[model samples]
Target chain A: MTPTLLGRIQTRWVLLWTIGLAWVLVVGPFLPLAGPSVGAVWLAGFRTLLIVSIVGTAWEFVYHGLQQLRWDKDWPTLFGLLVGLNEGAVAYVLLRNGLPLAIPGLTVAPFVWQFGTVWLVVWAVSNGPIRVLFPRWRFAGGRFW
Target chain B: MPRTLDPTDVPTVLGESDIARQGRRVLRRRFVTVGAGLGSLAMIHLWRLAGVADHALCAIGPLASPSDTYELLATNSQIPRHERLRSDSGSTIDAIWGWPGYALREAVEDSHPGSAIQALTEPVLHEFFTPKAGQVYRSVDREAARLGWSRVHQPGWVQMIRRAEGGGYWILAESLDDGPIAIAAEHVHVAIGYPGVQLLADLQQFRTDHPESGFRVANAYEAHGYIHDELLTRPSTVLVRGSGIVASRVLQRLLDDVEHNGAQTTVIHLFRTYVSDAQGDSPFFRRPAGNGFAYQPFNYPKSSWGGQLRARLETLDGEARAELIDGMGGTNTAPRRSWRRQLKRHEGRGTYRQMHGVVEKVVPTSDGVRTTIASADGTVATVDAAYVIDATGLQADPTTHPLYADLLARSGARRNPKGRLAVEPSFEVTGTRSGTGRLYASGAMTLGGHYAGVDSFLGLQYAALRIADDLAETGALPRIGPARSARGWLGWARNRRYDSNGVLA
Candidate 1:
């Protein structure tokens, strides 16, 4: 998507609220059901969601700068995938360091699983179904609304 | 003998004598979109989404669909139905929304997710996913059926567009079966595509000088299948010109014949300006280049579609916009692995060679055609070949089209720096606004307008969207909001018909 700064910010927020929130809610309850978990795992999911959204918003500015450096001012699909890794790392570091709020039992495995799944689902939907649902998304630089 | 009339006396409106002499029948509509190809179809699709009544719209041209002309040119250029076109998966002309793009549909039909995967990881992990020509044609056919194309389509060749007596425009056309017909519309859209295939001056001179050799020398966009057929039957040298996608396709076709049928064929690929390596003025803007070809995924940069470049171009005027367009515009082809491999394999076997020179002249010999080439240092040489295919691309001059020329003259429309019809950001032709009537144009004729990729499928759709929005502002149709857009997409998905009030039935 050859997104302008505004387009990137708008698309990130829109997809996070819809696709990201929905996926977190659907998978939140199942996490505690899989095995014994600590206090409010769903709450932790919401916390993680909050972190990704806030961190991702900041990341958009960096992406916009990087995009300007390139002639096309666009990111290939592969770059989009790679950015997920970069964002995941940043979110992981912040969550572990208690930047927002520290969870009672936020372990590495669960955090990885939860954060990784959310990222993948969001990315996949944005590339495919989101485009189908919002026809103007691509032409508007990935901004649906 | 011809009689001369005063220039000032010439009327913008056709007189009764002119109409009676031409035996014209007048048809009126609220909207008239010329060029019944992809561009017209795209615009009409937007009108349908806006809930414009079928009776209020008219599309006039000879072809029923864009595929009619596209397939012809494609086949002539060695891209048959089964071959893949150099277009992105989302650049589908069949649907304006571009939902369930060709990749998803093809992936489902073939029971393979390769196309889908390619679409997601293209230009880095893999080459871009391009839909086959047959698949695109089939999709367009389905959409055309749903659009009820026949109800609004009028078969005719547009001859002229002039100011009407009242406020609208009069479109004069000649119907092969029904004689002359004139259309009156408040809103007019011109999307008549490229003027025609351009032949190099040397080739044109050769064709005129030797009529018999005309069959041997031809533009790649024209019908020249006989050259390939003859080459497969005999050992002969073929001179391929240009370094664009068409040239690559033609070269692949020739090499494929040799590989599959064991035909003995030789190819002499000529380049007017060879690109030896990656080169550009700035490191940030350098295009990938190798093997005398400048590689680009598409004709224009991706940003030119909707991002920074698009915004930049829209804000620029005169020479600035033209300069930006020139930097982005040129003859470049997608980097196909198979074509590159074929070139390398043939080069090693002494069956293929590349030469850099300008063709100073071309003359037909008893056995073949001979071309005089001059190199950069003024070194001269001649090469004789059984066939020469000029793949230099098509003519884009607006004046070459009679209808466009007449409209420009009568409406006092100005041309852009690139000599194309100047269009407003809304795709409206400049200086063509009369009262409430507006004349908008798209496609190659408006190449140097606010958009860079005006000729692409996606570019055409973008233009249609802008025009639709403009019409909505003028109270011609309702603006498509999020709710309306959702309804339209659902209707499209469920194969529901569009009602007259912008609702799905």
Candidate 2:
């Protein structure tokens, strides 16, 4: 997708991802205070946890964001979430192959593959977490009990 | 604000003998008539909302007098005198403009200031301030009196509606007060609520098999006070078929009898597929309970009537609309906390028992109706109960109405994908648009039409308001400006009559 298309609106997942990355960067310097080798493994585990949380949270945003519209709260979206989970699996594989940042400068991929991997993460998060968390805001519609 | 009546349209004052039918009347000549209870109320509300003081509209239906229709539903449903309606306070049947709406009016009338304040501040409070069924009845009664309904309402059974010689349509009706009369009207709005709810097959079979037993079976629609009367005297078990609002209401009545009259009555709740958690997982729907009873807040979202959702529904095709309708369809009711608590108490006391099964057959027994049911776990058994209250809803098939069938045959009227009448966005029945005039249908009959909440109180209000605007656009009624609207609101507020047909008493 063109930057202009993505820039047109501040889609919820994109902002969530911005916050997530900012969090990781802020905490990255504190990893060594815990220990050396243990800290490295902990950082790897922390990154995986972030990926998982992002996957779970970002899918809703992607499903609604692709249509460039707000998600309808009443929509029975079990099928859509399943599809987002599938995309998250693919992102996890790409990250395993060292596409995304591994302690800042450790990506062993071509510029294009890295861009593709980042796009997939964005897509995954949008569909999963963002879509799940903030899909709708109508007060009168939806469940009463 | 009552209009000046023409000399030809003189009042028929019923003497002591005919006074029982107070709202019944005889009219020699009138330009048009739109019949039925809710439909007539809709027309009145529409005129008031638009601030149109008069029109050519008249109504001839079973609603003989003020509060007649309201009393029928409220009393039939066995709603206690002071009990609030199951729907939200926003759902109103009294006024069109709804300046204060139901909650505000009820709060004032019931003297519940906290409820009124809660309704104003916390919009999500479900049980904060709903109006009582009796209050609504009285409110409509007062409104009907003010609107000169006694003069305009002609008590009659509409046999059929056919095209007139040159223009408009002829309403063939046999008046209750006077004899057979015909009114040629430019527009006819049909709002017959429903044909009776069809009794279950097993009940029919049981009746046929054992004609001697004489145990009675009743549906929720009928005036089955005998069920309450019978239980009030002796101990009895009721096999209540169908799990909806009607079932709940029936149970409530039985419980009330048990509490006050020293009667012993048990409710047998039969279910087809008993989901363990009938309260569904979706945050968007107040789903039915595990006991096979609906517990939704209101019939539909507020947006279903006059908001963006309505506009969105209008944009979709018949198929898409039907799918959306299906998603929203099915039996549902408000989850009143008191009702839940009472039911829980009954369950603990062994007065209520739930079963998951479909009836294989029902045979007559010496004790009661012996019903053979097949359970979900492949178990089958036969049980007997004193009464069977079929709480299943009515059959709203458009073809069932003789007039609708005639309209379909004479005109090109058709059903939407949802098996209800297809209507234009203006609420005019799609195929019944004739020369310079139109035929409109409202309430449950217009279920598949542009509006989603067609059968709801607000839905009726919406249909009437839109139909009025559409009629005004076609030059059937006068244009309503700000001044006229304000006048109509004032008249309603002040308990003054502002007749839509421009006629006065």
Per-candidate TM-score against the hidden true structure: 0.94, 0.70
In each prediction, how many residue pairs overlap at the backbone (N, C-alpha, C within less than 3 A)? 0, 27
What fraction of the real A-B contacts shows up in model 2? 0.00
Residue range B1-505, candidate 1, lDDT tens digits? 0122232444666554555565689788889898888898888888888887877888888986756988898999999999999888878897766767888889999999999888878867898789999998998777676677777889878877777665778777776467778787889999988889889888988898899778889999999988888888889999999999999999999899989987798999999989988758777778788999988777888888877788779999999999889888787888889889999999999888999999988988998999999976689989899999999999878887666776677777889988999999999999988678888999989988889989888899899989998999999889876666767677777877655443457
lDDT of 2 by residue, B1-505 (tens): 1122232222221122222232423343323444558657767656544443443546778666545655676677676557766554545666665445676776677787765655544333334356677777777778777776676677877766655444566666677767666666667777766644566766666667676754567667767887789887778888877766677777788887787788899878787656455543445443445445554555654445543356567887788988666555566655667777778899899998888799998766666777789988799977688887778767778787666676666666888888878888777888776666578888888887677788777677667767777878987667555455656656666777655544332
What DockQ does each candidate score versus the true complex, computed on alpha carbons?
Answer: 0.55, 0.02
Q: Estimate the Cα RMSD of every predicted model relative to the unseen true structure.
A: 3.1, 13.9
Docking class of 2: incorrect
Could you tell me which 10 consecutive residues in candidate 2 chain B have the lowest summed lDDT? B1-10
Residue pairs clashing, model 1: none
- The Cα RMSD across the true interface for model 1 is 2.4
- i-RMS for every candidate (Å) is 2.4, 15.2
> How far does residue B174 in candidate 2 sit from its true spot (Å)?
1.1
User: How many Å off is the CA of B49 in candidate 2?
Assistant: 5.8
